[model samples]
Target: MKSEHTETPVTVLGLGRMGSALAGALLAAGHPTTVWNRTPGKADALVARGALRADTVADAVTASDLLVVCVLDHAAVTALLQPVAGQLAGRTLVNLTSGSPEQARETAAWAAGHGIAYLDGGIMTTPEGVGLPTSMILYSGSPEALAAHRGTLAVLGDPIDLGADAGLASLYDAGLLGLMWSVFGGWLHATALVGADGVAAGTFTPVALRWLTTVGGFLDRYAGQIDAGHYPGDDATIDVQLAAVEHLLHAGRERGVDGRLPEFHRELMAKAVAEGNGGDSYARLVDAFRRP
Candidate 1:
């Protein structure tokens, strides 16, 4: 006898890599999965794995109370769901498509108008990372919907409820991606800097990772300073880091490694020093990133 919780019927629309991964995770968790893709043949593998294939978007929407959509864009999502909006009403629409915060908010409005339970999502992993307990799947909009479907959604990844703002998931997604690229640029620059001295990246990376843990602690401490709008210089000040950036730039130049990434850091620190905020903690530079 299948318990009500164990037999969640989920309809996944769009068989793109991420969408397929979502359906596969659900199926592996013993959910009754129905999948549909415009190409039709895209669902072949999932169907073979015992997923039911819906021939049309309408059929897919009607097949399950929980609907997950991952497609090309918000525009593509609109094109596919608008015609079947009637069928979508009263069901949970978990949209994992990539788009701007505004787009997510617009979709949430449209869903609300139709009485559809909406959750705008940001998948914090590649398709390969799907179903991993550590991978985060951010959700915002409709707290009740998240509470109801959190279990079924956990099959995809760790479901992180981000309150009831539909736009927050997308907002955080863009910011987080920006943070990732910054870290990548810094790491790559450091790797090249050391590699210039005949040091292998593999040898340096493990040590670099440990440094990141210390940096993470810095971030945790700085977050409070930023929120309080009072960046205390009791810890290391921006002026101190500015001197360290000079050393990094000198080292990069001597080794013929590009100094652009560290140069940006130097520029920010120098600006703070010139503005007489150099005595403040490194987080004082957060003001440089904000509007006047």
Candidate 2:
């Protein structure tokens, strides 16, 4: 049986790991895919998988009305696509390049000037995760373009529309990456602490994951408190956490685990206590992160 979205032809410019994965997903979903890479050899595997290899950027751009570019950076995206601006008019260009929000806005403007429909994208998964429905691929700018190609794009991942702000996808991408790193750091620190007691990471991780699920519920509650500009300490107060953090510090110190991470938390909580905000919820710490 044929897939419903297979009719939209896709031109993929750039055949890096993620780009190759994107093209592979589109092809696997039965879309007619044309692929190109600066190093021509990169397209060989994709071509073998039934993707049409485009000899030049212009050929790639003209191959399909839905053009997806995943390149090294914003500069590379601009360098590759600027020359083919004439061919892109009336076509939709989806850029999955990693770049700043400012660069995304600039690219959206450039596309606008050329009459090209644009969607700035942030792929939330690594190359291996591409095409899985569980993976999220964020998109912003040109709601019409997103609406038109969403079915085809879904083959890459779950398409998350971040509204019409061209810069939002990149902004959210940066924030989400920072959150991932923070989670990784905390997990590693906890694993090391437990490892000192002869606990295997595998054994501790399942329990840690359950704890994270509980933490997620706290976040949902805290978000409401934050937005309301009120931090009720009904559940747990900063003063209580301040006292609890010292235990973590002592444990890390006794175990000879690096104490910097917990120390940072201690410092933040201590500062809030010193400022007479000890009765406030942990969400009150958001103030410490705001620009002074």
Residue-wise lDDT of candidate 1 within 1-292, one digit each (tens)?
Answer: 5453567899999999999999999888889999999999999999999999998899999999999999999999999999999999999999999999999999999999999999999999999999999999999999999999898899899998899999999999999999999999999999999999888999999999999999999999999999999988998999899998989999999999988889888888899999999999999989889943
Whole-structure CA lDDT of model 2: 0.95
Q: Model 2, poorest ten-residue lDDT window?
A: 1-10
Supply the TM-score for candidate 1. 0.97
Q: Local error of candidate 1 at 31, Å?
A: 0.4
Query: Candidate 1: which pairs clash?
Result: none
Stretches > 4 Å off in candidate 1:
1-5
lDDT of 2 by residue, 26-112 (tens): 888899999999999999999999999999899999999999999999999989999999999999999999999999999999999
The stretch of ten residues in a row with the least summed lDDT in candidate 1 is 1-10
The reply for model 2, stretches above 4 Å from the true place, is 3-6
TM-score of each: 0.97, 0.98
lDDT scores of the candidates, listed in order: 0.94, 0.95
